[model samples]
Target: MKFATALLLIISYIAVASAHMAMLWPTPRGGFGTKQYNGRIHAFIGYKDNVWKVRFPCGGYAPGPITKMKAGQTINVRFYASGMRASDIKKQPVLTKSTKQFHQARHGGGMCEFSLSYDGGKTFHLIGRYTNTCPDAYFKWPVKIPSNVPSCTHDKCLFVWSWTANILPQYYMNCADIRLEGSKDGKLPSQSIQIVDFKNRKMNVKELGDGIKHRASTGPTKKEISGNLSGNIPKALKKA
Candidate 1:
């Protein structure tokens, strides 16, 4: 009789523990989310489905592929106040100094060196080097062209670069345009690289090549573009 009673107690304890764990750790809660506070924004990192949440205030969220995250993997949530604009919120700038830069060197119509800067152009850092054997020789977002040491005339060129920022913005709200530029002088141009900022429900496409464009809309007011590039790039680029 005593043995049966003890067994029942053990099973009861296990059942209670399982139920408690489930209530405390729900699945979708393991990912990432953002919030605003005290004239600044913050980011949180923890199991969207577990029992840990650390808040780090900064500019925006860059959701990554959830399928790539496995159990026990280390995740980082960072926040920066310098990336925010005046119209984002009624708050002061977090960082007094803000900047970012990217540079690429080409050889044989391909990228030979890549670097970037963020500290008001005071310093630069090497991000990568490239050649035919590199795995990212064909990735096409930040266009890569390969040709000569100072000339990009080759049909197959590669470009490499880094992205560094002294501080991230507080929020990326009301972004109206994005632009990119290429040159024959073998030097990186100084200008804003146009990107579609989705929050304000707006689209900004700057002239790059002769045949590049974009259009945007929502519900029944969607827009379209006619160029070599098709499909929705911004729709697939949202951070989780």
Candidate 2:
């Protein structure tokens, strides 16, 4: 009887933990729960030292397989902010409410960027860019896979989603495992940097607003597909 009581108390405490956002489409929390879509949020892409998360390639490694899609493919990517159901993102205040206070000081609106990796999780080129305003529930983003993509038989190319927080100085990065079976228009970029931003630098929220600086090297939009993101591919990777 005592053990049962302790267990209940522990569960209650866990239920009050700080709430955060998660990816719903490539369903991570696909397991089972009232607040869980399928399973726990990005079980593989865990939090970083500062409570944020890893960048592209998600700490330079592949997490787990959710699903696979073809290249040059147009798909609607979905997101689940907090709680188990899609509607929970709208009622985020409920999950964020703790005993002492309500964590309603911020909104989930921010910048979402998608990128595709050709050579495993080593490097990635931008795919699509999404911007949202506060007091909005914009979750789905349309994306087109690069028609000219390489195939990965044993290994997996990465589908990366990076969210730059508008509410805080931190950001979250997650990776999806996918195997592409197709040809390439040309070679993938070989010489790109790890992104020009607050990475490895001191905490500067004001300068890192939105956390992303759209560069000429990326094609984060639909129309930009015809044109490549990085200038030189083989060269870029060589340097990388």
Candidate with maximal TM-score: 2
Over 54-126, each residue of candidate 1 has an lDDT whose tens digit, in order, gives 2211122222111122111221111112222222212321212212211111111211123222222223323
The TM-score of predicted model 1 comes to: 0.15
Question: What's the TM-score of each model vs. the native?
Answer: 0.15, 0.55
| TM-score of decoy 2 | 0.55
**Every candidate's CA RMSD:** 22.0, 9.9
lDDT of 1: 0.20
> Each candidate's lDDT (Cα)?
0.20, 0.43
Residue ranges of candidate 1 with Cα displaced over 4 Å: 1-142, 146-185, 194-240
